[model samples]
Target: MISQNTISQVFETARVEEVIGDFVQLKKAGSNFKGLSPFSDERTPSFMVSPVKQIWKDFSTGKGGNAVTFLMEHEHFTYPEAIKYLAKKYNIEVEETQRTDEEKARADERESLYLVSEFANTYFQNVLHKTDQGKAIGLSYFKERGFTEDTIKKFQLGYALDEWQAFTDEALKKGYNIEFLEKTGLTIVKENKRFDRFKGRVMFPIHSMSGRILGFGGRILGNDKKAAKYLNSPESDIYHKSKVLYGLYFAKQTIAKQDNCYLVEGYTDVIQFYQTGIKNVVSSSGTALTPEQIRLINRLTNNITVLFDGDEAGIRASLRGIDLILEQGMNVKVCMFPDGEDPDSFAKSNTLTDLSDYLTEHAKDFIQFKASLLARESKNDPIKKAETIRDIVNSISKIPDQIKREVYIQECSKIMDISEEVLFSTLAQIHKKDYQDANKKYRQEQKAFEVVKNEEYAKPKVDVQYELERKIIEILMLYGDRTEQFEDLVLKEDEVSGDLIMEPTIQKARVFEKIYLDLQEDEMMFSNEKFRELYYSIIDKLNQEEEFSTRDFINQLDQDAASTITGILMEDEKYGIDDWERYQILPKKKTDTLDQLVSQTVLSLRCFLIENKVEELKNNILKDNVDTKTIMEDVKDYNDLKSLLSKKLGKVIGSYVTK
Candidate 1:
């Protein structure tokens, strides 16, 4: 619970572009900025940031929101985490309010695990810097690897003592629950005994995209033949290795800044690259690359240069990743080191310029790389060559952009020495089959959705009456800034004259709030719940503003409403611009049209409310003749009311509104 002043400052001072730019490489596109989608693999830019609107939209995924939402989505941050992120980004001091005991009790178990993991990270880092064993072993190992003191601290490399129960003991001493530590895999719990999970290993903390410690990866030192060379934290609430890339927390900025990422297969590979002046590098940590892992990288940059040890298995693994990367709409380029070399050895053996130059000269597109690698074995074997061609075509089809896919297919035809027409035909067949399957599934789902939607209520037609009301509401929301000349009666008492004088002053009242208050007084409920909520929300916004701009209104609205408002404002009308000029767009026809729409919407809502009330009345119907007569009188009066509603609603509700 941050202070109100702090929250305001965070919102005010935190520029959307500035905050988002820290994570995204944004280039100016007109009044906005366009970048590769951070949420999806994209070659061409689909992520648009409107600096003016202070909002971002990812056209690839159809996800858009204000700055807070970008943090929440891209970083997987909770609402509080997003707020805190912004607060930290803007350097606003957070003043948390006291939480009740019940809230503390209800704090989630997953968060507790996160807390424990975080605590463990801090403890390990402290050990590395503070303790003799940590400095001599962990710090010494990192320094020996040519990592600078700053780099060591930046990556938070740490150490765990060889002594059993050292980490567990300290954590428990600090009042951390051992159960959570076990759950988070920070401690190994065997029967009733608990010991430090990464004991005697050089610690490498794994972080979530938002930089929270999710788990650890430790490298065993000395003659620990009984221990695995590298042990990673087991699956926990916060740690998902398949999705988490090592060094991403540090490399995200550099990757985004350079608009490209260097992918490696080990932690040391990442360290070596960073040490050798390539800051935008991350590792798969010796695991087979996952779609989730690729997606994680996809969120930061579109161009990926996969650096692999020049081994057959490494090349095969890298080939496997290329298709996944292509499927994500990312541009994939392969850069293999010399035979028997890895990123670690290669970077260390050469200067940064030499290493970078080698990568630039050697990098090849996936299709070309795969063809060259496979052709030697497949040559003169038509079946093998055909299979190879199909594999290349399959990879080409995985590309999201049709043009890019076609281009790849053409390139494959040239490389494989196959006909372009044949490859294009094959692609068409695959695409057609895929589309049909997808279309059939989508239609089946659509049919099922329709059945469910129709089960509770009959099919709805255009609700003419409600449409009128909605139209009026939209008018109020859109043109609410129209200042009408109104005379204000001011009573002023003058001491010198000893007389009170009545003076008339012209004042402008905002129509939006006026309509809003008027509707509130009448208890107006629109037929559509969403529209009703939106109506009230728009009114609330207007009330908060001194002068309302439709653009401002749209800016504050949710995406759907904003789009709807844009549609309404942008829609071209066939009827009258000359008429609009004379009427100030509020002539009888337009006003009557809007007024009619609004009246109809209100009437429909009123009818629904009245029917509900009637149901309640009927539920209580019973007893004496006097009571019966009163009920009958009320019913008769309601029938007359219905007739009046029908008459009033019938004119404008002719047929456009939808329920």
Candidate 2:
């Protein structure tokens, strides 16, 4: 466990823009930096980083938080991982509290796998440098591939020795459990024997976006006719190949900055391009491109230019990935090398300037590439050409942006020498079919969801006190520590006569104290359990401390409570871009309206509670023949109290009764 002092130090030292800029490209927007959201696909920037507040908000997805939270969200890192990441970025030493054996044993399975993967990565790298066999084979292979020593180390390239039990033996000797070894797919356990999985292959450690080793991609150097050329770590708790793109950890910042990503097909392809000065590139590691992968790229940039070898297979590969990119609302272009040249070979053969020039000169938009490629096959055959047109239209329909679709339609019509009318008509039919299919899926999902929801828990009916209770909690979070003058109507008992007299009193107190006293005087309690708990917790903390730290308060909460409070605090940022003052529509600041806001909120809550009491009394009056007169009197008294509260709020009694 990291010490609280260390965590606080890390939080204070880490600047939001500096930390996030490592992963995102942020351009100056007024006092804050704005960029495309890392959580969603959008061309116009909706993501803002506030250096002054030390926080960031993505309006597109409604995710906002401090630096640590950003890492947790964008990198899917655990709290500890995010803290460590920030600590490293800011050069702060993390101080740890020693954990007992039992506490260490209680660590989760996923974390164990991560630890094992990290250990294996270090072990492989040690072997590659320390062992003569690794140096001769793995190092030789990487060097022969034209990868510099720095590049090799940067990518953490390694070698697993040919001996079957070499890695398994070392890992077990180091106290790593065999179960975890097998779980991470580093050790293959048979009936009575255990052996290394990537034996004799040059190791390429694949990392998560946060730079944790999730898996490995190993290339076999020795030519064996029957053996596969490359072997990747099998899917495990920590590694999901479909959700990860190779070199993303290294390429994310550049991809965001360049406003484009270069897509390739293999690990070496990515390495070669990166080594040759193309930093904004990633590879599918030979798997067919998935929507998940495209969405990952979409988070960084809206544009992708796929680099393929000048061969039939490479062209087919580019064609396969284009629609997936289009479906995610990204701009895609295709660039093919000279005859028989892949990204790896071409990059090696040409200078950086030459390769860059070639890519710039040859990259074609998806529409043009599709038309030209399909046109060759459908030469002079009207029916084949018509089928090709539909194929193109199908791709166009996958585009999410209507404006982009129309532009592509215009381009496709011009390229294919086909009428825009026919294409639009085909597109309309396709859209109708898609809508029907989507509606059918939605209905099925809705039915399944309804069945589960009904069985587990019924939907909550709205309580009138909900909003007021939430508002109180919000005020306590936002202004609980601030001292303010409060006016109250209190009934005081005369010391000698023992008679109570009502009077107005004024006192200065902390906002939280005033709210607590006001609610206590009326014997009011929160209706929501979560909010109720948070309210008490806030009061307790305020009583103990002179000031409240919103971030600290949020950190002490569980995920649900923390999320709720964060949402409430960040709700105001929704209008951040509106700049109402610029249009002479200046709105009252919360500080200026604090007194009215608090009074109105409290009054509304009292009225709601009284209204509930009156309703209950009216219900009782209608229910029984014996107590109708008594219930009617109780209802009238409650209504009178409600009217008094409304009058105090300066509202006409009968006119505001419906509220």
**Evaluated with lDDT, which candidate comes out highest?**
2
Candidate 2, residues 201-295, lDDT tens digits: the string is: 99999998778999999888887877789999999988999989999999998998889999988898999899999999999998888877887
Q: What's model 2's lDDT at 292?
A: 75
Q: How accurate is candidate 1 locally (lDDT)?
A: 0.75
Model 2: lDDT equals 0.83
TM-scores of the candidates in the order shown:
0.73, 0.86
Against the true structure, whose TM-score is highest? 2
The true-versus-predicted C-alpha distance at residue 160 of model 2, in Å, is 1.0
Off by over 4 Å in 2: 16-76, 439-461, 483-510, 540-547, 575-588, 614-639, 651-659
lDDT of each candidate versus the true structure: 0.75, 0.83
